[model samples]
Every structure is written in structure tokens, then in C-alpha cells.
Target: MAAVAPARRRKRRSVPIGRMLLLGFFLVFVLWPLYWMFNTSIKPSDDYLTVPPVWFPTEPTLVHYKAALFAYRGLDGLINSLIISLSATVLSALLGTLMAYSLARYNTGGQHLSFWVLSQRFLPPIGIVLPVFLIYRGVGLYDTHIGLIIAYTVFT
Candidate 1:
């Protein structure tokens, strides 16, 4: 039997210099805001409005974090957010599953109804904001956790 020849390896293509530069520029542009946010968060309040801006804080502190999580009720806000999100998600999932099952099994409202329901997702929230607000006010669901959950469930 003849010995098998080794397979030739393919050469890797190199990225163009101009493309690399453009990618680097966009990377810096996107990451600069994140870096600034983190830097500012750790910096003292006095350093915030400096004319030249502080790129790196000489003395970083966790005072802001402490205040937000404790004094400013940030923890409560976070808990409320979690509650609202979980409730809305569970409700939406349950309702969506039931609707989908009915549509699949019974073909209720025919094909057009499913399409129409899906098309609602593409509708901009801004368009219905006024109507929703009025309805919520009328029903006295305004400024409540249940209200938020209901709104999120419907929108989502």
C-alpha cells in the first residue's frame, strides 16, 4: 500500500489595516462611556465637576455605593423591580402558553388572528401610552406594583 501524503494547511487571511483601525475606533467609542461610568462611580463627588475631568480618581471610595444601597432606598427599589419583573414574566408565560395551545389545537380565530396578535408586538408602545394611562387611571391601577406588572405583561 502507498503511504498517504500529508494534507496541505490553508493559509489564514489577515485583516486589513484600515478595517482594524476602524474596529479599534468603534471599540474605544463604545467602551469609553462604560469606563467613564465606572470611574465616576468610584470617584468622590468633589471630583465629578472638575473642569479638566478626573480620568482616574486618586482616592477612590465606595461612599456612593453605600449611600445608594442604604440611605437612598436603592435596595427597596431593586426588590420592587425584581418583584414586578418576575410577576409579569410568569403571568405573560402562562397566558401566552394557553393562547398558543388554543391556537394550535382548536385553530380558534383561524390563521389571521394569530398573525394579528403577533403584529401587536411590532406596534410601538408610545402610540398606546396615552390610552393605557387613561385606562389605568380610570381603573385606579395607577402608581401600584400590580399596575406595573399588568403593563409589563401586556407590553411584553
Candidate 2:
């Protein structure tokens, strides 16, 4: 036996003026700040603050980046943040994988657990920060990189 397919009508293609205008407006709106930030960032110190405002950086330099990590003593803080972030990311990936497997294959915790996890996301971080801060301090986890990593893992 053979089957016949039904005939289909082609879609009419036309760009609406309103949508095009909206797209153009959003493009400029989003990109203008990014363009201005880069334009200002590359300017030399002398040109960074000029009488007439040198918009194009006559003598561009990478000093701003150097100053951020060196002059402001941010290198240690940056390294600590990186360690915490990476640890949290790795732990989250492992736990998330196991949780997903259990939920999909074994239906662990049932729908109630899933609902509870989903609901936790709706609660603002500010609500829990105070209690968490006190508990972490008492347990000697406060101000340590491990504390930060554990906190990051829990948030997600």
C-alpha cells in the first residue's frame, strides 16, 4: 500500500517595519555602553582625564588592568576567588550529575523533593545570608576559601 501526502501552502515572507525598527533600537541601546567602556578604558592616564575629554585615547595603555591586580592589592583576593569558584563549579557538576541520575533512573525523593529544590530558588539570598554567616563563623568556616566554595555550591 502507498500513501499520498497532503499538499502544503508556502509561507509568505515579509519583514515588518516595526520589528526592524525595534531590533535596530535595541542593538544601539545594548552596544553603546560596551563601546563607551572600551573607548574610555584604553585611554592613557594623561588623556584619561583631559580638559576637553580625549574620547579616543591618544596614547593607549594597559595600565588600568595592571593597577587593578597590583596597585590595588587584588592579586591575592583574585586568586582566592578563583580557587573557591573552581572548587564550587567542580563539586556542583558532580553532585548535579548524581542527582539527575537518581531522579531520572531511581525517582529518588519523589516529586516532593523536586518541588522543594525548585522552591528554594525563589527565596532571595538575602533571607538566608544572615543565618548562614553566623553558622559559618561559629564552625570556623568563615573568611576561608572553603566556606566560599561550599556556599557557592549550595546556592545553585
Candidate 3:
């Protein structure tokens, strides 16, 4: 009984405080870029690129949001982003569910297929930019919203 008690306690010790703290730190680190982007959008560009970098804008303004939403084709970019994100979400969900069902019923690892799909995600935007630029240029879609949508769809 004593030996069994120690084994159970030992299993519970697998996740220690250090691991928890490290995980919390990693989450904060990973999310910091997103937080910074939102923060920048709320702040004036001058304050955004300041020395020491402000953690929180003292005078948070909606000027950037207004500019992005209502000024100079920014709204068009937002709409394009929404369309791309929604399309990718729908496609990925449908494909993932179908693939998962097939794998579950067939008892296949399907790991290589999943790995290849995941590898597509690892590709940086820069990797395909030149090819896309050339293609869009050839097609006379240099600055068109449809071109941007097609480019995003292809990458996804």
C-alpha cells in the first residue's frame, strides 16, 4: 500500500511548478506580438516606434482604427482579409473532418498526409511573393482585390 501511494504521488509530480511557470511564460511570449500589433494600431505611429517601446499607450486613440476602417483603401484590405480567413476556415474544417473520419474508420495513421498539410502552413508569405507578383503582373491584377483573394486562396 505504501509503495502504491508513492507511485500515485510520483505520477502527479510529472507536471511541476517550473513547468507551469514556463508554459505561462511561453504563452505570454507567443501572444506578445499580437498584443503589440493591436497596441500599435491604437497608438500614433510616432509613439509606436519610440525608444524603450511603450508597454501600454498612455493616450490610446482610435485614430488608427478609423484610418484603417474608413480611409485610403484600408477598408478594402480588411474585407480581403476577412474573405481569405473565412474561406480558409471553411475549407480546413470540412477537409479536416472528412480526413479524420476516414482515418478513424480505416485505422490509418494518415500522418504523412497531415504532415504535408501542416508543412504548407509553415511556408512564409515571402517564399511565394515573387512568383505571385509575377503571376499577378502577367494577369494584369497588380493591385486588384480579386488578385489578393486568389493569391491567399492559393497559398491556403
Candidate 4:
């Protein structure tokens, strides 16, 4: 008599328990800090610096956000920050794109250019901050949005 053939087993489509645990831990690590920041931002001034701190606000409030956006002290600073940040971002993208095109198309050897760009990142910001501050003072552009844009462009 012929023997019957056994059926083939399909592979299981599941992650290993170890991987799942690692992923869960990583997600909690990343998200918990952000959640804490938002939580603190929404908490009342009285509860902000308490011992152990509150994970979730007992009486959630929008006062901090409202003050940040609409109040006299907050709104002015926010506007100034937004203007400077947006200006810098736009300028950097434009300049970097042009620089990238030049670097890509030109047959300048890779190592030197790479070193040049990498070197910029190593220079301590504190070392140059004072000279920049002095220049801005001389130009009468200190504390101004345009001055900030110029400074950021030069540094980046």
C-alpha cells in the first residue's frame, strides 16, 4: 500500500515577542516626553512645578496656549520668532539647493568638499557668538528680524 503525503505547514506571520517588546518600549520612550511637554503646557501655573509633577492635568486649561498666542507679552515674542524662523528656513533651502547643484554638477573631488561642509558643524557656536553680536551692534541691526535672518544665513 502507498503511504499518504503530509500537508505542508504555512509560515507564521508574527513578529518575535522580543521585537514587539522593544518596539513598545521605544514608542513609549519617544512619545512620553512629548506628551509630558504638552501636558505641562496645558497645566495651570500653580501645578506646573509641583513635586513628582502631574502626568495629566486634573483640571485641564487652555490658558497657556491662549496667553502664548494672544496676550501682549507672549504674542509679540511669538510673532518675532515666527518671522525669523520662517525667513531662515526659506533662505537656507534656497541657498542649499543652489550650493547642492553646484557641488553635484562640478567634478570637484568628493573628499575636500565633504570635509569643508562637515567642518562647519564642528565649530562651537559660543566661539563666534560674540563677534556676531558685535557686528550686529555696529550695524544697528541688533534685536531686529532682518539681522537674525542675515546671521542665520551666514552661519548655516
* Number of clashes found in candidate 2: 0
TM-score of candidate 1 against the unseen true structure: 0.78
Report the lDDT tens digits of candidate 4 across residue range 41-119: 8898989889988877899999888877787588788788889988999999998898888787895766599579868
lDDT per residue for candidate 1 within 80-154, as digits (tens), equals 999999999999999999998998889688679999999998989999999999999999999999999999999
TM-score of each: 0.78, 0.71, 0.44, 0.61
Per-model lDDT: 0.95, 0.87, 0.77, 0.87
Error of 4 at 121 (Å): 5.8
lDDT of 1: 0.95
Best candidate, TM-score: 1
Model 3, range 1-156, lDDT digits (tens) per residue? 344444443445467889899999999999999998888888867897789888888888998778767886788877777886787667667766887787657746655765776688888989889988998899899887567656655565
Per-residue lDDT, model 4, residue 8, is 86
Backbone clash count for every predicted candidate, in the order shown? 0, 0, 0, 0
Off by over 4 Å in 2: 1-26, 107-111
**Candidate 1 lDDT trough over 10 residues, lowest sum:** 102-111
**Could you tell me which residue pairs clash in candidate 1?**
none
Clashes of 1: 0
Span of 10 residues, lowest total lDDT, candidate 4:
106-115
